[model samples]
Target: MTDQPTPRAQRFAGRRVIVTGAAGGLGQVVAELFRAEGAAVVATDVAPAEDVVACDLSDDAAREGFVADALAELGGLDVLCNVAGIQQFAAIGAITADALRRHFDVNALAPLMLAQACAEALVESKGNVVSVASISSVMGQPYNAPYCASKAALLLGMRALGVELATRGVRVNCVSPGGIATPMVEAAAAGLPADTNWDLIARSTSVIPGFMPPADVAEALLYLASDAAASVTGANLVVDRGVVW
Candidate 1:
């Protein structure tokens, strides 16, 4: 039998990466994966850790502070992965203005604020950004108006920023992943009313039977952060198993 080929070394040997919401779930996976790939990873969440900083993304000042702290801790930053978000479900008739704004603050505004704050350093290093969008961004989700709208805004924001930053050598892109096994997913599932028909929603989405793990989405983020994607930018990679394609 022929021997198997040896795998190549990591692509982020000297890079420094920042991952938001890193205490658990997708953010945690992204941070761990980057560390595995040889990058100096700085993970942040709403709570503090030995290496992680407390970052309340809904607060604008906290967002700025977190961006600064990441650079200060890492010495420099090469990749900014915006994966912090919240999910709330409410019917259109029942959606409150506060709820909608809260979603935007956590999901859309936080990423934009971080990107803007890190622009100078990212441009200096010719770094890249990877945002965690959602399949809901492309397809309207029933009873999840705020979440869907926030994600949609995030997608467009990344696309527009990619175009603006391309000339400066800082690449920007987003990944819209389907239902992944995360705390957010569980929250969404639990938020459904007793009479809500999840099967109907799932059928409408038509996603594959299995749940996509956080690592599955993080791999795509790693790829975008690597030099292999040197020419890729302003792109929205849909990793939803053909959902929203």
Candidate 2:
């Protein structure tokens, strides 16, 4: 048989991209995929690698610092993928102000701030921003109030930015993947309390069984950032197999 076709190979040729949280999980997959599609990618994460620039997204000064480094490396930006976030499991009774602050700091605030910092360059290129939200953002998960709340904030904030940046031709959107097979999910699941109720947590699970592969979610990000989604802004593309659609 003839070689199978790649789905839009080199779709991002000549594009410059920046992916946060690029050291692990879905972020790693996203960065690699974009580069395969011919985009020049600059990657960063709190966990540094030889190729990944390290920046603690939770720090105020660090956000801008990372943005500057990313922009400088790319010379300009054509797309920004906000894949960094904090996902944790905590019981309501055990949750504290510090927990909420920590969740909001990374999951919600950092993405929004990064988008704002990159807005003008994106406007210049008519680029798009895609962030990784969560299925929990659309529906609450048991004992995950902080994680759910923070992701919900991210979803709405991106939608609002989509509207504000529309006049400037910069699209903004999110991908709320369902349970993904990633270290973040594994850690969160492992941290669940002994009294955790599976039935309750199952209520918000995907119609399609099992956790998705991170590469699958990366496809969603690529679609939203591609010209294929030129008219798709202010939207949350749920990749959880109809969990939130």
Candidate 3:
């Protein structure tokens, strides 16, 4: 099914939120859902969109600027949803330093940097951070060293933040999805090497078979960001159809 916001109530009424990568795919769905739930969202993405501010998340200056814009537009921060990421697959022999850096910069470092930029605001508002990790983070995925490594880093970083920010009244968590039916995933799967091992892939494949809809994964993210998860912190809620087991 296509991504659609089915907000049942104003769970985030009067909340000020920062949503990265809001231009398309799961990010777009997350932003739409937050707004539908009465959140004043400050959305940004590297890809230019009408309402999404252009911010190259890998750059420190741009991150600071985006945080500034968020604070200015929505006042104080109530939640930070780090939905921006890059997932490029490369076989072990093909993995390079540049590839590793590119993946970590966007997938892992960007989320951590954004959290640091909004730390005080989050603490002040007693808010939380919910990031989108990947099933590769908790499982070994072939031809995806960089993506997997970076996602693992993202998961650890969120856990570290969850502990560091807990006493400050700020929470941090992640939703590690096995796979989502997005253009990014489709392209990566299409570009896999011809000599790829199908049997090895099947070892960790989701029991549900195909990738999940973006909306389904987005729901997990929103749940972690909501007050319904008040006592939850440093948790990596896996929504990967039992892939990690």
* Candidate number with greatest lDDT: 2
Q: State which candidate, 1 or 2, has the greater lDDT.
A: 2
Candidate 3 lDDT over residue span 37-134, tens digit each: 99999899998997799999999888888788779888899999999998876678887899889999999999999999999999999999999998
Could you estimate the TM-score for every candidate?
Answer: 0.92, 0.95, 0.95
| Residue ranges of candidate 3 with Cα displaced over 4 Å | 1-7
TM-score leaderboard ranking: 3, 2, 1
**Local distance difference test, each candidate:** 0.86, 0.90, 0.90
For model 1 the TM-score comes to 0.92
Ranking by lDDT: 2, 3, 1
Clash number for each model = 0, 0, 0
Evaluate residue 50 in candidate 1 and report its C-alpha lDDT on the 0 to 100 scale: 57
Q: Which 10 successive residues of model 1 have the least lDDT summed?
A: 200-209
Model 2 agreement with the true structure over 171-209: per-residue lDDT tens digits: 999998888999988887765788988999878877888
